[model samples]
Target: MAVQEMKLREKSAPARVRVVVEEAAPPMMPVIYRRLSAESLRQALRKMLLIRRFEESAEDAYMRGLVHGTMHLSIGQEASAVGICAALDPTDYMTSTHRGHGHCIAKGAQVSRMFAEFFGKEDGYCRGRGGSMHIADVSTGNLGANGIVGGGIPIAVGVALSMKRQKRSSVVVSFFGDGANNEGAFHEALNMASIWKLPVIFVCENNGYGMSTSSDRSTAVKDVAQRASAYAMAGRIVDGNDFAEVAQAAFDAVERARQGGGPSLIESKTYRIRGHSRSDRNRYRTKEEIEAWLARDPIGAFERQLLRLGFITTADIDAIRADVEREIEEAIAFAKASPAPSIEELTRYVYSD
Candidate 1:
């Protein structure tokens, strides 16, 4: 009887439960990492590097009196240009601001032809007519860079309207600065686009200033993206220096627009390390702020991210740098050797052919 009772007690004992906690699957990579091929990412890094080197070279040239007239340099906003353009099709159109070298290059303009334009040579996209601030490569679908603040916004809206009427799948990306956000054209264009459900993307490269004036002093809204609500469109704010973030936002907006989802606004919160223009003394901001932003160099940050993701090796980066350097040197040589437009032919393109 006692043996039976002991057996029953043993049988009643609770069974040990084994807890198997499978290590949580590594956090899902971002949309860009999953969507873009390795080659595409490498190309992105290459373009970022190229923009940096090109801007630096342009600055040096301006200082040496090789380039005439005042120019705005997109020295620190490389990622915003590259990331946004990466999401665009070759057939799509783009409008640029005065600070638009990066945009031109990102949209597939050749550095040689661009250099020729800067040199005012006949080989330029504008046949030596439009220089730095007005470089336009129609073959690459770049309408033109606007010297007037907020000028491109209305143009983009019009282009979008045209596309809608034609039933074409192409979209237009209008890139402007923080200052342009306050302009009347900005409001008018967005309202019209939203009402028509036009395929357009309004990208505000908000680099903390509209010329020498800080945006906080000039603008009412805390974030430029907040303005999109008035137009009943999507608005997103991203770290413009982070390529992945900018690209992801652009990709979403582009896809949405392509699907007839109407227009979207992306306010890239970036900082321009350089002054407003070649002549800006940069008295409005402190040296410490500039230094801090310099530390977040978009090219360097993107390079590091690429390395971490194993998309690029040190050797590859070195090779890309060498190649871009050689390319720039060749471009400079080509520009110097190209012929300038003669005075007799200066007014050739002023009228319709």
Candidate 2:
């Protein structure tokens, strides 16, 4: 009876103690600002703010029926554009996606001309022939922003080829979305770039969704950087929200390409705070998901970092904001005052022959 009682007591005792496995802390990213000058940091902040304000204003213009046709805004993905472009030399070339205003702005295109182009004015790039999705500034090495998904990949490869043939030291950077990775052009361009060892950097802005479809449903690979393996090139994943991280990856990739190390792929995991287009109601995502991303706003986070690092003060930030606001307002005024393209010049730029 005593033995039976002891057996029962043992059975009633708690099972083996459970041990929780703690996850390791992520490694620290390099301090990019330490290597950059104060002027560079200020410029980055200014450019990022300018892109945000410009996008906000553009949205308002679209709603007011001032901008015609469809428009894609990179409101939340400014860090990826600015960070990567800032890592490049002034003479380096870059191709942008439909959501490319930020890329143009980061690469030093005049805001007045960008607004003028949207307004369809004669003084605008492309003389108002190209709308929001087609802005290009050859003088600044901005090849142009493509409307078709994955359209700019091959164009960037072609530019790289031209540079290679000319024996130029310049490199080309191609920016595209997660959706573009599924396209055939992406595969073709990467393959050719690989075989020829073209001086190009293929940047994939994996913003979680391609239109309304989540990347989880569309892409087979969890990380777009894995695609580089198929091409036998180097690839990396970066925190697109962290400007320092993106800039570091871009710097390494740009340096590699410049040194004839061939092409590299960088997948920047980011999110779009705004809808895919003006007409989108964003019903596909939940408020909770959006709020989570909003908490990680690149501009706000960077501002805090700058303050904490003593790189800038609240007053400095405010001054930068005021300056950017004034500049954007002047750009809008210039666009408003500029005249539309003349009817006689309609067919002038239509044909190559």
Candidate 3:
């Protein structure tokens, strides 16, 4: 446990410590969240690390010919996924983007099952019907990962609508990139959610680019949060790479929605560490830009935060990384021995009775 730790650098005072456990819990804008217990913090960090390792291994598996279809990596975007996930209860639903492995892990989906699903095995969560792009664990309140841009946004709004109509307190969150913000569905969903005062939070992970296009090149407005005002909802612009800040902001919005305060838009200004997909040459972005974001890597940043806050020992972190790597390796093994879904079963799940 003897390890030199890092310190928590304050970018801004965090919103207050009002964390609601259920969908109906009240909301508050705390300056900063009440410091989570070491166990709580550790669990969140472990999940994030697990996500990082799982994604890295998945990428390797795809390269090794074990997993088919497109695979998205959430390597550098761990905190944005994990921290917000920490703010919610298991009953709260979530919708994920194409690069949604981090969301899967953070939302408590089983790693082995996810891998099996990706490998198209019968034991997989979706029974091999949904592959990398369509992973879902209903037990964890994950609706599913949508392949289409802005596709899940409307779905999340529907879930929130259902929650309100049924007198359910659960809030639903939709995680997407800035590219999704420009979609017509995004505007439509936001308008409805605002009008209905639906318990939904639109989480925009502005990772600088949509596929290969940079944000500035594609987006006319500098801030996606600015769009929130059009809907008359709260707009929170935050550093997505900062785990604490992201978690705090999300907690506030989710709580607000739970208590009938309505929807909020959180623009998490972060970056992607990998190319848009496995085959991306990354020619659209400069090497220096990637390097700059890497310098502030979310995983490394959080690890340092734990160390500085004396929340975790070097031994603890080492154990965490080692365990994550081991779990990922196990997932790969499970995936390798698995068989692909049969060609004869293509018509199943295409329609529900």
Q: What lDDT would each prediction earn against the true structure? A: 0.86, 0.86, 0.82
CA lDDT for candidate 2: 0.86
- What tens digits encode model 2's per-residue C-alpha lDDT throughout 1-66? 111101100122232212121222334435776678878988998899899888877877787877
TM-score against native, each model: 0.91, 0.91, 0.89
Superior candidate under TM-score, 2 versus 3: 2
TM-score of 2: 0.91
Q: Rank the candidates by TM-score, best first.
A: 1, 2, 3
Could you give candidate 1's per-residue lDDT for residues 1-353 as a string of tens digits? 11110110012222121111122233445678788998999999888878877777777778888888988888779999999999999999999999989999999999988888988899988888889999888898899999999999999999999998999999999999999999999999999999999999999999999998889999999999999999999999999988899999999999999999999999998988778987888889998788667666777767667776688898888788778888888988998899999999867877888
Off by over 4 Å in 1: 1-28
Please give the lDDT score for candidate 3.
0.82
Candidate RMSDs in order: 15.6, 13.0, 8.3
**Tens digits of lDDT, candidate 3, 32-118:** 436567888888888887886677667767888878888877667888998789888999999998888889889999899999998
Worst 10-residue lDDT window, candidate 1 = 1-10
Model 3 root mean square deviation, Cα atoms = 8.3
